[model samples]
Target: MTHATTTDGVRIAYQLQGQGAPLVLLAGQANNHHWWDQVRADFHPARSTLTLDYRGTGDSDKPDAPYSTELFAEDVIAVLDRLGIDRADVYGTSMGGRVAQQLAARHPHRVAALVLGCTSPGGPHGVERSNDVRKALAQPRPEAARQALLELMYTPRWLDSHPGPHHTLGDPGMPAHARRHHLAASNRHDAWELLPDIAAPTLVIHGADDLLNPAANAPLLADRIPGARLELIPQARHAYFEEFRALAGPLVLDFLTTAPSRP
Candidate 1:
C-alpha cells in the first residue's frame, strides 16, 4: 500500500514484508508485485522482500509515454532511495530480468546479488520465440488465449491435478496503450554488451521447455555475465518458477545465501 514517486513523476506502488536482509522481487511482463506470491514465503526468516508494480502494471501509475527497461531500473532505484535502503539482493523474472540487467550494470554498488529467471538479453543477438508459440499467443479470443498460456506455463500432468488459478498480463483495467508500451519496452531491452559490467554475484535460471524465452538464451546470459551461474529446470516451461517453485525457490535461496556479493 506504500508508494514512491520516481524522478519522472510516476507514482510507483510497492509492498514490503518479512525481516532481515532486503531482497527485491521483480515480476514478469505486464505483471505487478503479486507475481512472486508463490515464492515470497520461501525467503521468509532469512530475507525481507520488496515487490513493486512496474509503471504500467499493478497499482503503479500508467502514463502514455514510452517506457524502457533502463527507465524501469531507475524507478526501482527511486523506490529504494525513498525507503533509505542502500543496497539489496535482487531477483527478477522475464521482463523484470531485463530491468535487473540495467540496475546491476548501471548501479553496481546498489546490488549485493542478482538472480534472473526465464529472461533473455534482447536485441539482434537474442533468440526469438518459436512461430508456433507466437501465433498461439496472438489468439484474440480471451478464453482461448488463457488456455494457450496455461498450456505454455505448466505441464499437462500438473495442470490436470492442481487446476488452480493463475495470473495473466496486468490489471484488467490497464489501458490498451499501456500494455503496448510494456511489450515495446521488453522487446527493446538490449543488455548484451552491458551484461559483462554487472558486478553482482549472479545466477541465470530458465526452463528447458520454454518457448516464450528459449532456454538457449540462459547460457548466453550466463556466459556473457562475468561469473553468473546457469540452471535449467527440466520439463518446466515459461512459468518454471511457479510450476517448480519447490525446486526453483531453494536453488535461488542457496545461491543468494552462499555466493559472495562480488567475485
Candidate 2:
C-alpha cells in the first residue's frame, strides 16, 4: 500500500507490482484497484505496474465537488511526480480512458505508450446511455443502481454466468451512496474532441457487443489518432476484462511489452 498527494490535496492509494518499465493503470469508473487484479498476473515480474484507486471510488479521499476527467488526469500526474517516475506506459478502461486521453494530450512527455479499453470518444453513439438507464443508476436504492449498471454495461451472457446481479445489493461491499456518486462521476465524463492530440504509440481495444460504448468507437478513435491500431474482441461485452480475464490480460501484456518506445 502507498499514498501520493495530488495538487488538490487528495491522497491517492496505489500499489506497484513487477519491475521493468513502469505501467500506470487507471481503473474504470466506480471501481477501485481490485479491478486490475486478474490482469496483473500476465505482466512480467521485472516490469513495474502501478494501479491506483481514484478519488471517491476506492481507498482515496472523496471530496464533495463535481468531478471531471481532467481532475483524474491530474491525479495520475501526481502519482508520477510522487513516485519519481519520469516516463511510463499508461492504460485506461471505460471512464479511465477519458483520463488517459487527457494525460497524453496534456503531458505527452511522461507517457511512453497508451492503451485504451472498452472506451469511446463520447461522440455520437459513444458510451452515452439512455435516459432510463441513467435514471436507474442515479436511484438511491442499491439494487436499482446495480441493476442499472448490469443492464447498461454487461451483456446477457455475462450477467447469467457471473455473480454480479445476484449480489447487487452490495456486490463488493461498497455502500449505495458511494456507488451512486461514482456512477454520477462516470456519467459526467465526455472527451470526444481530444483524441487528435494524443501523440504516443496507441492501442485501442474494445468488445464487439459493448452496448454502453459501441464497438464502433474503436474505429473512430483509430481514425483520429495517427497510427493508432484498433483490436475488437468478438462476442465480448463492456466488462470484457472480467469476462475473459485470461485472454484479455495476455493481450495487454503483449502490447505493453512488445511496443517499441521512442528514445
Candidate 3:
C-alpha cells in the first residue's frame, strides 16, 4: 500500500506486488485497485504488478469535479514517476483502457506495451449502452445497482455456478457522485483520431457478449491502431477477466511478456 501525489495535489493510492518487470493494472470506472484482486496472481512472480485507485475511487482523493481521460492518464504517470519506473507494460480494463489509450498516445516513451480490455475508443464509432443498463447503473441503492451490473457483466452460467463472496458496496466502493463523475469522464473520452499515434505493441481484448462497451468496438480499435491484434472471448461479458480468468489471464500474460518485433 502506497500513495503518490498527482500534480493537482490529489493523493492517488497504489500497490506494488510480486517481482519482475513492472506491469501497471488500471481499473475501470467506479473500481479501485482491489478490482484486480481476482486476477492479480496471473501477472505476479513473472512480472511485478502495480494496481492503483483512480481519484474519486477507493483510498484516492475525490475532488467532486469534472474528470477526463487525460487527467486519469496523468494520475497514472504520477504513480509511475513516484515509483521511479521509467517504462512499463500497461493493461487497462474498460475506462482504464480509455486512459491507457491517452497515455500511449500522449506519452509513448512511458509505455513499453499495451493491452486494452472490454473498452471503447468512444465517439460515433463506439457502441452506446442500452437505456436499461444505464438506468440500472444509476440506481441510488448500491445493492440494486450491483444486481443490475451482474446481469450485464457476466454470463448466467458463471453467476449460477459461482455465487456470493461478492465484493461489498460503499466506502472502498464508488459513491453515487463519484460514479457520476467517472461516467461523465468516460462519456467524453474520444481517442479515435489518436489511435494511429500509438507506437507501442498493442492488444485489444473483449468479450463477445459485452453489452456496456460492445464487441464491435474491439475490431475498430484494432483496425485504427497500427499492428494491433484483437482477441475475443466467446460467451463472455464485460467482466471476462473475473468470469473467465483461466483464459483471459494466460492471454494477457503472454502478450505482456512477448517481445515486440523491431520495425
By lDDT, the best candidate is 1
Q: What are the per-residue Cα lDDT tens digits for candidate 1 across 1-263?
A: 78999987999999999999999999888888877887798898689999999998878999999999999999999999989999999999989899999999999999999999999999988999988998898899988877888888788998898686666344566678888999999999999999999999999999999887888999999999998999999999988988798999899999999998553
Residue range with the least summed lDDT across 10 consecutive positions in model 1: 164-173
CA lDDT, every prediction?
Answer: 0.90, 0.76, 0.88
lDDT of 1: 0.90
lDDT of each residue in 1-263, candidate 2, tens digit only: 58899887889888888878888887787678877775665665646789888877567777766677778888888888998999899989887887888888789898999999888777453545457655776899977777776765566767777753332122264556656766676666666667787888899998887776667788888788777988888888777776766777777778877777764
RMSD of each: 1.2, 3.3, 2.0
Q: Where is model 1 more than 4 Å wrong at Cα?
A: none
**Candidate 3, which ten residues in sequence have the lowest lDDT sum?**
164-173
lDDT of 3 by residue, 1-263 (tens): 58999999999999999999999998888778877887888888589999888899888898888889999999999999999998999999999999999999999999999999999999787888888878988899988987877777888888898785544122356677887888799999999999999999999999999997789899999999999999999999998888889999999888877849423
Cα-based lDDT at residue 127, candidate 2: 42
lDDT measured at residue 228 in model 3 versus the true structure, 0 to 100: 96
- Model 2 Cα shift for residue 229 (angstroms): 0.3
Output the better candidate (1/2) by TM-score: 1
